[model samples]
Target: MPGVAERLTIDHVGQRGDGVSLTNGASLFVPYTLAHEIVETERDDEHPERRRLLQIDTASPERIDPFCTYFTRCGGCAIQHWQPDPYQAWKRQIVIDTLAQAKITCPVDPIVDAHGAGRRRVTLHARRGSDGGLRVGFAASASHAIIAIDACPILDPALDGALDAARALAEVLKPVSKPLDIQVTAASNGLDIDVRGTGPLPTAIITALSRIAEAHKLARLTRHGELVLMRVPPVVTMGSAQVTLPPGSFLQATAAGEETLAALVLQLCKGAKNIADLFCGIGPFALRLATKSKVTALDSDGGAITSLQQAIKDTKGLKPIKAEMRDLFRRPLVPQELRDFDAVVFDPPRQGAQAQVERLAASKIPVVVAVSCNVQTFARDAKILIDGGYKLESVTPVDQFRHTPHIELVARFKR
Candidate 1:
């Protein structure tokens, strides 16, 4: 049994942004407890984990009821208890803290909130439960526990329905001869569903699902209204150019987000005749910038490079943009390779671009746009750039993932 800690008065939230207080001078982290709250905590003696709040003796006025039914159990979102305004502010602070850690000081501009924001392109997960039902949802906070969800408020309506359909299918499918994982995307056609497992989906299952999808008018395995049997289809037009996106490929989840990012990249590349785009997935920025300047797009994914090459071939008005497959972790872009480019743009994963920061400093590109999802890593990398003698220009926070702690930022740097 856990020990009962004396009631503690909550002072404020900690780095995790959860309300924090002290019990007998030992630190305690409590979720859903706001500033100036008094709470009784249950301390876990078995482990080094923080004590849990058992009950709130006093609650803050800012606390509100979460809109989602699964707020407590579903790990898709954090900070649901915070009001919208404060939540946004906290996210901004996170970006600031990240930049500070990197030893870079820049004026963070007003956050750009995403409109119609819940359109997620893909979600993947394993089956769950004793019945082995498909548990298609985000992993629990800091744990592997799968949170089975019927609907995700943050996902596009079309994609949410697909999740439901997948759940329904899981109910009827045979219990556990194999594992099941799924991916759904909103393509130009409608919605596309990719069901993957150890073996090919039985013909009967596919036929049955197809019928169900048609009857329900659900989008399945199609792009921009075109029927595609394979999950990964060949090239489509990016401004009259053939560009292919492979299955499991990384593309901007939202069409609007992609457009917004493209515009920003082009704007930043102004007056630059040469550019380098690192981790350039599917040439979202590289292809777009091609109209203005010669761009070299680098990514580790070979399949993506194939698609990018195809896109360049199909587009008539595109400026010369070349794609290469290189593992950044093993071999980062060096000064020699970067000397030709007047500017550089990088979009790294949530882990941030720490591995390549040194090389970026060495290149000293006159202009750099560092796009990031993780604020902490972004700040860390920003510090490196500052140390490398780059001046921080501006920090723009884009609400790519609304109603969640996740944020996207574009930090401009100049030498």
Candidate 2:
């Protein structure tokens, strides 16, 4: 049985998107509650500083019925109750506050909302139920419990029936009733799926999977880095180039989000003839930049680099683009190598690129556009650039992951 706890009034939303309240001068973080809301909460059994919301006594005016039936039960979304305008403003404020902590202040542009047709990719957890059947869906918030979803509104309509797809595959691939992670990506041809957490498939399983692929007309099926079959190539269009995605390719969740990020990047690096795109995966920005300038794209992933090279060859009208495999974290282009480029664009992973930024700081590159999804790391990197005599030009917040606390941004720095 759950224990009874004190009633708490939520004061504000914390940095991690949790509702914060003070009890006897100690702070408690509660999930699924909003600022100025009254709720009954108890100490979380798993976390010391956390409180589990038991009842909402007073709700915020911003609250609304979530579009998805599985809002709080699923861990994907954080603040779906917020109205769109307030949500956008809050996202921009989060960026501003994060940058302020690093003492870098610049104009923050209005956020670009790209919650388009819906997310093109999703990874669901599949496990065997007690009844020996399969359970397929997202995990519950901060728990291992999987919440089976019949329909997910945030998914692209093309992926609306993905749970059924996952279940069908689980039924066929359940060799020993183990849990699996089904990663599905919607592509130009059809669904590109990757199944993980399973052992080597026997010949019979492969034959059955091939039959499933044929029946569903799947674009491609991959099992833990091994290719099972490809009914058709999984291709994605970025600008004029059509990229044949390598299995487990990193793609923006929605097409509009990619376009928005690319448009902002192009606008920031305008008039630059020579540009180096560091950590460019399959040329989301470099391929588009090639239309006007000489571009050199580099990434740690050989597959991403090879895909970019092939796309450059396939596209007819793009300017010269050179793709190479280089790890920015390990061997970031030093100052001498960076001196050749008029400007540089880098979109690193959420950890940010401190090593690469340190090198850029020592260089004389006239313009630099830094794309990032994490603000804390982005702020640290921005400080490095600013201390190197770079002017903080503009910060544009991009709402690529809608309803989630996650934020993407493009920062322009010029020296």
Highest lDDT scorer: 2
TM-score of 1: 0.84
Per-candidate Cα RMSD to the true structure, in Å, reads: 4.0, 1.3
Clashes of each: 8, 0
Candidate 1: stretches off by over 4 Å: 1-6, 40-48, 51-55, 124-126, 131-143, 168-179, 196-228, 231-243
**lDDT of each candidate versus the true structure:** 0.72, 0.89
lDDT by residue for model 1 (137-207), tens: 76775566778776677676646466765665454344435555666776554555656653544666656
**Deviation in Å, model 2, residue 92 alpha carbon:** 1.2
lDDT of 1 at 157: 62
Tens-digit lDDT string for candidate 2 (1-415): 2486768999888767788897789889998788899998887778888888888999999877778889889988887777788778888999999988888889999999988888999999997767876778998888888888787888888775567778888889777567899999998878999899888778998888888877777889899868988988899999999999988889999888999999999999999999999999999999999999999999999988988899999999999999999988999999999988999999999999999999999999999999998999999999999999999899999987898889999989999
TM-score of each: 0.84, 0.97
Off by over 4 Å in 2: none
